[model samples]
Target: MIELRGVHKAFGANQVLRGVDLVVPRGESMVVIGGSGTGKSVALKCILGLVHPDAGTILVDGQDVTGTDRESFLARFGMLFQGGALFDSLSVWQNVAFRLQRGAQRRSPVQAREIAVEKLRRVGLKPEVADLYPAELSGGMQKRVGLARAIADDPEIIFFDEPTTGLDPIMAGVINELIREIVVEMGATAMTITHDMTSVRAIADNVAMLHDGVIKWTGPVARMDASGDPYLDQFIHGRAEGPIEAVR
Candidate 1:
């Protein structure tokens, strides 16, 4: 569903992505794993058009997204940001229904709220919690709300950035399971970038290891352990010694 070829992006003297080539098949969960400053997030932003590539091409469903209509292009996507990124002024239901209440696909407030509440339930949040503000909830609850919002419009593609960050192991596991279940139920194409091995194991059908602004490895999750790539080994095992530089 998504493909990138020779994608390059640089910021001043720092070159983040030298030549990133990746493909996420339709209805599959592909998780990009890499160490910090390895351009995982930059790669994602490039596809989302938040960061323009200096060269190369990005195609969604075999069509170039470069000059596509922004509104229509974005309507097919849903994203869960690294942090909850909820609007402080909005209640939980309002935040989840944010997309439904605006733009070309706008819906009535009642309809939006009902959809929001249903999504919240899908992510394991009670309907009453939708009336509460973000600040009133715990970190895990906020993440669930974010998940609810991402799926609110039933997007065809979903991007999850650091889905398991800032949560206890148990909560992280819960969130990971929820992500996997939702993706399967919705049959949406998913691309996730995370350093969390547990999250990758839980949510990915395929894994791609990004290092030095390029994909060092890409394969099914089942074959990851036997892939025999030093970079992939170093990452999945959290080793200090390997081909990857630890200081970076």
Candidate 2:
């Protein structure tokens, strides 16, 4: 459903992406794993058109979207940012129904709130939480709200950026399961960036490792443990001593 070929991006003097290539087939979940500052977030932003790539082509359903009309491109996908990135002042329902209040999809606030409540319920959140502000919720709750908003429009594709980063182990697991379930239930293609192996196991059908600004390995999630690639092995095992250089 999505494809990137020879994608490259650089910021002034620093080169981030170096000839990156990736693909996410329809109804599949692809998880990108990498250490800090490896350009994982940059790659996601390129796909979302938040960051324009200096070189290479990005296609959505076979349409060339590189630096194309962004509004039409973004309307087809949903994004759950690293920190949920919710508005501090908007109520939970308003946050979730944000898209419904814009463009041709605009609806009355009451109608939008109803859809938001239903989406929240789908993510296992209660109706009472819909009236609360983002500040009133816990980290886990905020993440759930973000998720509800992502799926509220029934987007064809979803992007999850470090979905489990700040949550406790149990809460992270819950979020992972929810992601897996929603992807399957909605038949939506998903691309997630996370370093958590637990998240990979629960959410990924295929896994790709990013290193030195490009994909070093890509394969089934089950093959990750036995792939025998030094980089993949080092990352999966979480060893300080391996092919990967330790961050000083």
Candidate 3:
């Protein structure tokens, strides 16, 4: 459903995402794993059209997304950022329904609130929290709210960035399961970027490891342990002495 070919992006003298190529089939979930500053987030942003690539093409459903009419192009997918990115001023329901409540594409307030509440339920949030502000909720609750918002419109594609960060292990596990369930229920293509192995195991059908601005390994989740790639092994095991370099 999504494909990237010869993707390249750079910041001044430093190059990131050197000729990155990736593909995600329809109704499949792909997780891209990499260490910090390896252009994983940049690649996601490029797909979202938040960042423009200096070179290469990104295609969604066989059409090139680069230079496409972004308004219509963006309506086809949903994204949840790592930080929850909620508005401090808006209530939970408002935050979840932001897209449906504003811009040229607007849903009625009553309808929007109903959709938001339904999505909140899908993400395991109760109806009572709908009126609460972001500040009133815990970090995990905020993440759930963000996830709820991402799926509010039920887009054909979803992108999650560090969906399980900053939560207790148990809560993270809950969120991971919720993500998997939602994706399966919606039959949507998913691309997630996270370092959490639990999230990887819970949500991914295929795994791809990014290293040195390129994909170092790609395989089914079941084959990860026996993939025989030193990079994947080093990352999955969290070993400090493997092929991955540690800067002083």
> What TM value does model 2 have?
0.97
| Cα lDDT, all candidates | 0.95, 0.93, 0.92
| Residue pairs with backbone atoms closer than 3 Å in model 3 (clashes) | none
Q: lDDT score, residue 149, model 3?
A: 89
Return the lDDT, model 3, position 114.
Answer: 96
Candidate 1 Cα lDDT to native:
0.95
Per-residue lDDT tens digits of candidate 3, residues 87-186?
Answer: 9999999999988998687999999999999999888899999999999999999999999989988889999999988889999999899889989999
Encode model 2's per-residue lDDT on 89-161: one tens digit a residue: 8999999999998888799988999999999999899999999999999999999999999998999999999
For model 1, how many clashes? 0
lDDT for each residue of candidate 1 in 155-210, tens digit (9 for 90 to 100): 99999999999999999999999999999999999999999999999999999999
Q: What TM-score goes with each of the models?
A: 0.99, 0.97, 0.97
Instruction: Return the top candidate by lDDT.
Output: 1
Task: Please estimate how well model 2 matches the true structure, expressed as its whole-model Cα lDDT.
Answer: 0.93
